[model samples]
Each structure stands twice: as C-alpha cells, then as structure tokens.
Target chain A: MDSTVTTATNESVWGGGNQPLGASYGKLMMWFFLVSDALTFSGFLASYGFSRFKFIETWPIAELVFTHVPFFHGDYPLYYVAFMTFILIMSSVTMVLAVDAGHKMQQTRVIWYLFLTIIGGAIFVGSQAWEWSTFIRGDYGALETKGGRILQFVKADTGERAALADFAKNIPSEREDLQRDKGLWFQSEGYLTSRSVDEVVEGFVANPNILIRTETINDDNHKTVLTREESLKRIKDAAHVVEGANLIHNEYGSRLFADFFFFITGFHGFHVFSGVMINIIIFFNVILGTYERRGHYEMVEKIGLYWHFVDLVWVFVFTFFYLV
Target chain B: MAHAHKLEIFRGLLKFKTNVQKIWAVLVFLTIVTTIEVALGIIKPQALTHSHFLGMKVLNWIFITLTLVKAYYIAWDFMHLRDEKNSLRRAIVWTPIFLVLYLIFILLFEADYIYNVFKFGFVKWNF
Candidate 1:
C-alpha cells in the first residue's frame, strides 16, 4: 500500500501538490470561469464575422450607417464610439489601482479608486444606451419596398445621406362626418366603414405616376438634398412617401447587423455592470479591514483578474464593432 | 535597538514601498501607447494604406502589433505574470496564445472560403 501511494504521488503533475500554482481555490475558479467566458465571446465574434462574409456586398458601411442624432442632423463619424472605448479602458486602469491599494491595506485609496471605476462603468453603460437609441431611431431612413430591399438616397453633389422626411410630404386628413343615429330598421349597431386592401390598391393604381420610387432621390449637399425631377413628379401624383422601417429593411441600418450589435454589446454591458457590483462589494470589504485581518490582499488580486477580463472583452468588442 | 536596525535593513532590501511608483510609470507608458494607436488609426498613412504584409493590410498589421504590446504590459506587469514561476506563467500565457492563434487561423481561412463562394457562386445577392 505504501509503495502504491508513493508511485501515485510520483506520477502526479506539479510535484504531486494539490495546490499547484500556489493560487487560492477562489482565484483558480475565477481563471476557469474567465477561460470559458472568453470562449463564449469568441464564438459570438466568429459568428458575426461569418455573417459579415456571407453578406459582403449590399451590407451597410458601418461608419456611414451609424452616423446620426436626434437633435443634430449631420455627419459625425467614429469619435463617439472611440471615446466610449477610452472610458472603459481608463476604468480598467482605476480598477487595477484599487486592487493594488487593497494589497497595501490602504482602505481609503481602495475606496476612492473603486468609486472611480464604478463611475466609469456607469458612464459606459449610459453611452451604450445612447448608442442603442440612436441606432433604433435611425439616421438616414431607407425605403422598404415590396421585394424586401432597402433603397437609400445619397446626395448627388456631396454624397451625404438624405432623410425620408426630406422626400415625404404630409397628406391632409380626410375625415367624414360620423353618423350617431341611422333610421335603417333593426337594432342599431356600431358603424364599420374603412378602406379595404383592394380599395387602397385601386386608389394607388389610379395614380400610377404619383408612386415615387426611393431610388430616384439623391443627397445634394451637407445641408439640403435633391430628388430627381421624375421622382418629384411621381411624388406629386402619389401624395406621400412610406414613413418607417419594416421587416425587409431597417431605417436605422441593416437589421442583421443591428441585431448582432445590440446582442453582443448588450451582453458585454451587462458584464461591466456585474463587475462594478462585485467591485463595490469588494470595496466595502476592503474598507472593513477584511483583507488586513487575513494578512494578505489575495482577494483584491482575485477581483483584479475579473476586472481585467472585462477590459480584455471590451478591447475585442471595440475592434470588431467599431474599427474592423 | 538591534531589532530596529534589522527592520531598516529588511525594508531597504525588499523595496516593497516603491512598487506603486513602478506601477504608475508602467500605466503612463500604456496610456502613451494607446494614444499612439488611436492617432495611427485616425491618420492612416498613404504608404501604409496601400501596403500589404502577411496577406493583411499594413494598417491592420500595425494595430495587431501595438495591441500585442499592450497585451504584454497588461499581462506581464499589471497582472504580475512576470512575478510568477515558469510553469505557472506558461500555463496562463501559452494556453491562450495557442488557442487564440488556432482559432484565428481557422476562422480567417473559413472567411476567405466564404468570400470566394460569394464571388463565384451561382447565388446573386446584389440586385
């Protein structure tokens, strides 16, 4: 039995020690979790790359499509997203400092650094929300045709985008007088009078020249755009242009890109949020002298691993979502 | 009096108090590198734009190189990988390096294949 036990011990890796790497159980678990998380994020990014390849052409240019605002209607490129990335990276720096302070048993410093990290994370989340809202609202709205294709207008002169509202004119309401009472015989019932599909189709067909195609319009300059004379004539006949995004095409951008962007970034934002919460908990513990009592700041080091993992994820996300 | 002298000697030898200063210097260097990356990305020199190395655009190569540098500092210094033993360090670093490289190779090849299909295949996505 003794010989067998000796052989087993010799065969074991890491000098037969159970506690290899000298890492605490918690830290080891964190490493494992991070590895798995890394794989999960890589899967999402790979899928995105594959889809991008599958739709290489006709896919929207990310920079051009993403530029828009609610109040300001003009061209603003990659600056906003770049700033958000900087914010997240800076937050990671603060987190590292906080962990360092914890190791030194400097409770006050830890508190301050952790607070800064939390603030940075909150700002990032807010910026992501703004980005999502802008994406959902769209900038230069595209026309969704019956064939499920998006047709966007570009300025003929400057190649800037033209909004849907630029080409669409409002049609005056044609409300009929409501009849409260009818002398027709039987029990009175609610009146039902509406334009049926066939009627609407007939109305549209009656004015073939008025049905303006979106492709006929072009952006002319930074400020004002122009619609082709033929398109203008068609619009004069048709009365109104179609107004929002639809199943075939999104006004904001490509539906698939938007969907993937939201899913990936939203997931990452959730991770940042949870990381902040964990940091806060660790912050309180540091202040309460928990690590000081334990004679080491290994807990801080462990949390540092988690914080750095979040930073690493953001780096990849920034590259794929913005730069690439 | 003897114990006090020994304590002073211990502090002198360990230099434990100055780790923070070293860390701050490293952090400053990292900030500079990141700023450089952003600047390069924005400027995108004409020479670099047209040049290709290793089947990738020069700009992409630059970005990857700088990113690796940043990763090095973040892992080796910030995460204290440098302080770890050889086996422990290898376990942490080599695993990720090997796995990520393998993944990139497979994915890039797959992407190129798909691009070829789109270029030559029967299906016409463009209207």
Candidate 2:
C-alpha cells in the first residue's frame, strides 16, 4: 500500500497523515498513552474515593498518617509531602527547560536540564520508598476489634495519642515460640505482634490515663474518644493486636485506605522509576550526538512530555489522597 | 533552531523576555499555589473545617479547587499546551475530562448508597 500510487496527500485527514491535529505522530501517540494512563489512575482513585466515602467516618486522616519528616519526627504533618510535591513541580520546571533548549537546538542546555530532572525523579522515588516502609511499620499500634475496627489509645488527661509500647503489659506467660521441631507439620505462624491481645487489654485496664479512641469521627470532625468504662468494654472484644499495616489489616483505621495508598502510590512510584531510566538513556543519547545527527531533538521532547505527565498525576494524587 | 514561540503565560497576562525567565515565572506561580495548599491544610481554620458544603468539608472543596488550578498551569505552561495548535490541544485534553468525571461521579454515588446500607441495615457500623 505504501509503494502504490497514493490519491491523498500528506496533509489530507485520512491519508495516514502525520499532522492532522498539527502534532507529530510520536507526540500524538504519547498524548494518547497519557490519556489512557490518566484514566487508569482515575479508576484507582475513584475506588479509593468510594471506600473513603463509604467509611467516611472511619477513614484514616492524612494529617495524622503522613506526619513524619525525614530527620525530624515530631508531629510535622504534611511537611514532607509538601516537600515531595515541591520537588516534583520543580522537576517539571526543569523538564520544560529541557524542551525549550531542544527547540532551540541547544544541546548542552538540554543535557544539563535533563540531568537535573533525572535527579529530581530519583529523589522522589527514594522518598516514596521510605514512606512505604514507614507506613508498613506503623508507629502507634492498635487493637483490631472483631468487627474490623481499630482502637487506638490516647491520654485521657492530655488528649495526646499514645503508643502500644508505652502501655502494653510485659507478660511472661507460657507462650512458646513455635519452631520447626515444635510444629506438627512444620507450618509456622507469621510474624508475631510484640504485644498480644491479652497483654494489651491487661495493660489498658491497669493504666488509668490511657483511653480508647475509636476510628469513628464525631460531629467535631475528630475521632470519638470513649469514656473510661467504655474503653474497658471495647477492649474485651479485641480479636487481635495489630502492629502495622499489611494488605489485610491496618493499625491506623480502614484496611482499604492502606490498600489504595499502596496501589496508587506504588503505581505512581513505578512510573517515576521508569521515567528516570528513560531520561538517563535519552541523556546519554544526547551526549553521544544521536539526536544531533538525526537532525531533531524530538526524543528529548517526547520524554519531557512523559515527565510532565508524571508531575500532573501527582497533583491529583496529592489533592485527593492527602488533602481531600 | 531560532523559532520558538514568544515567552508569555496566562494568555499574555505575564510576559517574559527569555525562555529561562518564563520557566522561573511558572515555577514561582506553582510554588505559591502549593504553599497556599500546604498552609490551608496545616492551619485548617475552624470555619472551613466545621462547615459542610456539598456533603463534604468546605476546606476540602478549597483544596480540590486549588489543586485543579495547579494542574491547569502545569499542563498549560510547563507542558507547553498553550503553544500547541487548537486541534492538538483539544485532542489531548478533552478525551480524559469527560471519562474521568463520569467514572468518579458514578462510583462516589454508589459509595454513598453502600454507606447507608452499612449504617442502617443489618450490617453493623463497625467490625
């Protein structure tokens, strides 16, 4: 078909045209991919919204969840996430600069800016990994009720949140650590919690200062703090003492929150990782005079489009997941 | 090599003499918007937090609006959508908006119904 005589010209709309929309084939394809990728992300976030809205009263608060800073960890809510957003935006700025340099055929400027963008992406991926670990290894542990609700403890007098380590009883019961020899068929239990349900319930009863805070949000927009008698009553229904978040359980609140948090952010993190790798390849290609010989720097511009798309998705993620 | 569009933003609301200058201008605007979002999130003034609008917190409405503003500028300025042809711009932008909005609306409404079932029905509120 390509070698045969053609009736339609390159400018024609149905002639397998390259510029019907005044965009190159590659650029248009990249945009199309971005549109679909965006839809995938929207699906994930929408489901997250569904679960969050359904459990609106008990959904984990972002401010309380993402409170740790890199070096300093003292109730610095949204500080690190704000920093991550800033870095991503700044990387977008650098990517734009690289594209502008490519347009001008300034190879050196394009290389430098691309290098900066790669660095920014690297930093973001690193921070996201650290965040994942922090989330998995939760800070203050809680008791998982039989009905799947979390019961965190707070100071009755000060109203400050308390950690499991602070009040869990150091019980020296005959709880044997199962090994291969002790097991009937060599099947072993998973990682055991530091504090058993009995250990936690016993400690809660002994400590008069510790009060139970249910995951439910009251009219005041804060978690419901139960009375002293209610705390004792609630602990009796404790099924297990959950230490950290996994696919099934979370010490913080709803398991759906952790599920979405892991899936959405993990997908975004993978995108950033692949983007950096692509940028690196393109950076070397620029240095090796590949684009210079090809007579256009469109490759750099293509990668730039991808980089900005990553940044754009983060804007929504930051808003819906963290802020809203 | 010489022909890149003139450096301006916001439909010429802001003008920059150099491409570098334009990049910094966009960065500054993005920074300002992000700062406002972070400030509002942290301070969370009582009035915005306590009130309800559209069945959600007014503060959340504010956050979502500002985030859209940030996304707009990133796509428009940083990604150079502003400098592209009209047809190209529409092709890239229009397809996602309709689908995403429709999807989100349907899912969220379903979530509300499920929430009621959890609340008043046989399913206990917690467990």
TM-scores for candidates 1 onward, in order? 0.73, 0.94
Q: For residues B16-118, write the lDDT of model 2, one tens digit per residue.
A: 8987898898899989999999999888899999999988889999998998898888888777787776666776788888888999899999999999998
- Lowest lDDT sum, 10 consecutive residues, model 2 chain A, at A1-10
Listed per model, the TM-scores of chain A against the true chain A are 0.72, 0.94
Local distance difference test values of all predictions, in order: 0.62, 0.87
Q: Report the Cα lDDT for residue A85, model 1.
A: 71
- Write model 1 residue lDDT over B1-127, tens digit each, in one string: 0001111111245332355655665566666766776676556677875677876568767777766777676666556656554556676777777787777678867977887786799865432
- Tens digit of per-residue lDDT, candidate 2, span A190-219: 788988898889889999999999988888
Give me the runs in candidate 2 sitting further than 4 Å from their true place. Answer: A1-18, A181-186, B1-6
lDDT of 1 by residue, A154-273 (tens): 545555555544433444455555444645455454432232223333433343232222422122211222245644333233211223333334644345676678779888989988
In model 2, residue pairs whose N, Cα or C atoms come closer than 3 Å (at least 3 residues apart or on different chains), thus clashing, are A147-B127, A148-B127
Off by over 4 Å in 1: A1-18, A68-74, A145-149, A171-249, B1-17
Per-model i-RMS: 7.1, 4.9
